[model samples]
Target: MMFRKIALTLLTATLGTSGAYAKKAPKFEQAHQLTSEQAALVQKSIGQEKILIKAIQQRTPLVETYIQDTRPDVKLYQIPVGDQYTLSRVDFGKGFFDKTYETKDSANKKGWFKGSLASITGITKALGLDKHFTYNPTGFMQMMFLDPTGFDQQHYVFSYVRREFLGSVRTWVFDVHPKVAGMGRFYGRIWIEDQDGNVVRFNGTYTGPKSEDDSRYYFHFDSWRMNVQPGIWLPVAIYVEESTRDGEKQVGLKAQTHFWGYSLKLPTRDSESVSMKVDDAEDKSEDSTDVSPLQASREWVLQAENNVIDRLEQAGLVAPLTPNGFETTVLDQIVTNLVVPNNIALSLPVHCRIMLTDTVEVTTVGNTILISKGLIDTMPRNEATIASVISMELAHIALGHHIDTRYAFNDRLMFPDESSFRRINMNHNDHDNQEAAAKAQQYLDASMYKDQLSTAGLYWSQLASRGGVLKALNTPKLGDSLLKTDGTPWMATIAHSAPKLNWDDLAQIPALPLGSWLKTDPWDDHVHQLNAKLYAPLNPRDKMPLEVTPVYFRLQRYDEAQSQAANAAAAKPNPGAAAPANPPAAGDPPAQPTGQPTGGTQPPAGTDQPVPSQAEGPQPQQTGGTPNPQQ
Candidate 1:
């Protein structure tokens, strides 16, 4: 679910009082029309929604999110692990339903929030007044408007939007508003597939009650949906972009949420290997030693690389599960673009892997390039920035400054990541590093990315403004710096087209935080696409690039999962209940269900103390977007 707290004083803005310099001055006109068929379809869904919602409340879909809060004061700084944004994150499961909130903010007295324009009180409570931000019982499903009560005529006014094809499905879209402006009412647009009339997507915010002090207002949002089953339209993602005024200043912030693994309980994957007997085995491809000794040795190295990859996957540190499924495809597109233009080819295909960590680094193991999820998240949002990183590695490959065959021993697969770093050496001597950098420069000049290096230069200029903090990102995970040598920047022509970097300039966004553009699964760790919507926060202070948010899952798993959680909570005292207890066996205390607190009079368990689990904390990221460079 998306939460928009930036204040837009529609009451004043509508009165034509704040138009002089208001960024989002004109505002989206609340105008719409619906055909009779569309109205009937919507009514039908509203009546039957409760039943579908009940079923949804039973299953759990994996939830993934990333939030980035950027402002002038939120500069890159050395924070414990490394230089990072004034950022916060949330990564958890159960669609983020029935989840607790956490933050990286340590010093907590009367902290002023940077993004509160609509609801200053709400932000004040979260940052200064409340012990911690908590999810309301209504839960994230509220974001989808599946609750029948929400759509009743007494509360909402609906208007027909248009008939548009979202993908192959033609849909009837509508604008929604609350009869009265209050937190309980939803405001936005909804898309319904013409055939079923099920709400395919809803984009907007709920009406919040007027503040007595007149200090808060609701922020705008865009929610979306996807068909998971034949007749089931599931809410897949929510994007929130809020712009609010803080006194005379305006602020902006961006946030994204994702939901997947809906049919996860049912077997979604099948074995691709064919069943075979001993006879089939005897006719297998070939023996490893069949090739010439030199060729066989190279084959051994390849097999070893595969082994290392498999080990990383099992450890939850590789692509798809790590930086997410997009890494492989992204690497492929880059390689395709570079290889075809530069006429570079290899005997075996090159692969890319991502490590899911906050460390900014990159390295190559055999033909595969390993990039940290953090680096991908922090880099300037441009294809050229990515190409620059890849070119350096490709240069190393071309110059043959590579990992020795020492790791060809499959036994090395058992080594841990830290230990393997010492054994699977991919670093080059300083002299070789310089040669690779020079060669990488030449290769880029001869490739398609060369013309775009001016933008790539802008990236380097920004990175350099971090005053050496970005140098770590330039440093290879296992080798010498790709963009820096010694203490000075090495990409001399990297910023050929961009303006100078200015860290203190609120008008300029120098760099994004880790995971600003990518999201990771809290379950199987698969990464997926966040809705690529844009929100230009009119006020720079409201530009929160990466911030912590309350977890609001699309559904709370109250069916069997609720029973399981209850059984687990009930059995907590007796640590030995083998069978799952239902409805509290005999004399035992009643189990606190998923949404409600066990001890009613008291607040939820983590109200006072922050959640300690990083994986359990609230997460958010900036949406990945950049103008596509012309080839």
Candidate 2:
């Protein structure tokens, strides 16, 4: 056993060294020593003409057959315009798959068209096209040559790779790649017949970005085409298997072997035979053309300005008077401060009009910015909230957010349409960072607009109290549709039961600039019923306290004169009235009641007697008191 192990070790070491030595050896020497026939074969393989001819003879006719045998989820059609044809189809596999087809015609006319399954299905049902379901042979043949771009080159690149025998048919296999980004679905390999270059069988896999339906790949197409007519390739059947990484799969199969009986062709004339030679004539005619660079530059500038205005109008940022003045000012400041100084050429102005809405939304049309009303409404009644909104949008603009060169026209500048937009969700990145927060702090520290910041916070707090609908709309969560989703806050969740202070109590409190007038009232007509139900009862006792109205404070006052008669009446004494008798002193003992009167006046015993006054000056009345002397 030990001897065997040593022998095996030696063998392995020998093999490893030999493999390493071979890899280090020069590869160019072996290539240079190739036989003449082998070199000729290599040259023949890469030649463009041979490849083109093989592709045309093998793949061109199979195109129509492939369409005929396309999965039921995909519909193909031809649109004719002025003797030219445009082919387009809608893939119904995922949520409304949109695709356009373009082709070049023999008459040098370019044809391009788009149609969705919704449109085609309506047409088919309306015209009863489904009743005549038989395959149209002539239509299938014509579809192959309808190139929308007026060019004969195929949209897919094909390279002959190998030859293999499959189920009694010798096949020529080729590798195919899409030449354009939005071309039809791409697969890895295609197999054709070795005898006449007709595609016999094909097997390949397709991969692309994950779709909305969780599709990780576009479609995996495995199909077989046969030569039904001599040297004419046709698709016998096709199969497609779709899947995602999560083990979801949808398999489909389609077959189209028979052809329509009818065929039509346009009348032909022998124009080549009737052509005659004409004498060549040359005339010397020259005209001078003048071009002005200044005029061109002015025109270009005007066009750019017009485009900006149009975009602003569409985004609802520009009005007859406003004309996005705020946005323009912000952009100018940014350009002057950051972009121009840094030598960075801005494709779009660094300005955005952010709509204050419940949810956060940031989008741009040309140089105009559109923010949600909800975002603005939810902000604290202070400048910081405003700064927050502006800074968020400004970050987008400053970072060159809406700049795109993929689409030729500016009309297609949509952030959601961008490839990168799909990669990121609500997460904030370097582009939209904390610049707004920082700027707000800076302004607050500077004390330049302290009141505005406080007001902004109040505003935001009020908005937040109303709920985060504005924030939600502006920063929409997944599945929130613009047209259908109800992003409003629920009444049950809001803290609507505010403290009920009487009007008198409210009035008595020291007044601030805030709540001088009723800011919000439960009984207000504008208040929603749901909101009103949630509000606490308004107290009638709450009164608006009396403050010095400027007008009232400026009024004059007057005093009445004193009267002499009133003073005399007040000084006169009451002569007819008698004073109340005083109580007996505490120290004096009870005095014995005298039966007989003493000294000044006397009365008979046992008789209730009255005292008589002396002198005729004043007379006493029997009623109980003496009459006035004047009477």
Which one is best on lDDT? 1
Q: What is the C-alpha RMSD of each candidate to the true structure, in Å?
A: 19.9, 42.9
Candidate 2 C-alpha lDDT tens digits along 83-202: 111111212121211233222112112112122233223212321223323332222222222122321124545555666676456555566544443433344565544444444455
- Give the Å shift of residue 43 in candidate 2: 89
lDDT per residue as tens, model 1, 230-302: 4555656665554444555444444455555454332111321238666544644664335676556556656
Model 1 — TM-score against the truth?
0.48
Lowest lDDT 10-residue stretch of candidate 2: 548-557
